[model samples]
Target: DAMVIQNPRYQVTQFGKPVTLSCSQTLNHNVMYWYQQKSSQAPKLLFHYYDKDFNNEADTPDNFQSRRPNTSFCFLDIRSPGLGDAAMYLCATSRDSRWQTYEQYFGPGTRLTVT
Candidate 1:
């Protein structure tokens, strides 16, 4: 479905060696984002793309990276993961253009383990 968040739920994660997950929306929202969530934790914005515009959280680790070369495709690249890196990777998008952060939907997460 368009204008919706797929896989809005996820599993608990443990300390991690490396893990990567994904999300996509058919709505073609101009802004797309990836969030980090720990077990029993709140979702945290890792990074997002505003139609080829890349924005990263100040505290986000260097191990985390992203790419959006086209309108409908984006990727999350985790160079190296640590125990603390074990968390949900959420993909989301917003309809608003001209750089606005609005309400978003979530995707089912990929659980990771650090062992």
Candidate 2:
């Protein structure tokens, strides 16, 4: 089935080390988003790309960055992996229709473990 896919479902990194997580989709959607979710906390919107136009959430930290080289792929780079940064990183895709509605399809998510 055409859907989002995340690589390295489980990642182990040392604190202060750099790590990258990747996401790809086969749906060919115009919008792609990255979210960080911690245990018992709501998923936080980190950033997104709308057909090459990158949008980063204002509250997102400087340590968190994303890159969408093309429509089918996106990457999340954690400049420095901290203990608190250990969490599930999710990638999603959506298309906004003229009807003013959007439905997002999410990937299984990449879990980062920082030591």
Q: Which candidate number would show the highest lDDT if scored against the true structure?
A: 2
Question: Taking the candidates one at a time, how many backbone clashes does each contain?
Answer: 5, 0
The residue ranges of model 1 lying beyond 4 angstroms of the native Cα positions read 3-20, 99-101
For 1-115, candidate 1 gives per-residue lDDT tens digits of 5643434244333344344454566777777888877878888888988788899999988988888777666667666667667666667777665556477765565555554
What TM-score would each prediction reach against the true structure?
Answer: 0.77, 0.95
TM-score of 1: 0.77
lDDT for residue 97 in candidate 1, whole number 0-100: 54
TM-score of 2: 0.95
Rate residue 80 of model 2 by lDDT.
92
lDDT tens digits by residue: candidate 2, 1-115: 9999999899999999999999999999999999999999998999998889999999999999988998899999999988999999999999865576588999999999999
Which run of 10 residues does model 2 get worst, by summed lDDT? 95-104
Please give the CA lDDT of all the candidate structures: 0.68, 0.94
Name the lDDT value of residue 37 in candidate 2: 98
- List the candidate 2 regions with Cα displacement exceeding 4 Å: 97-99
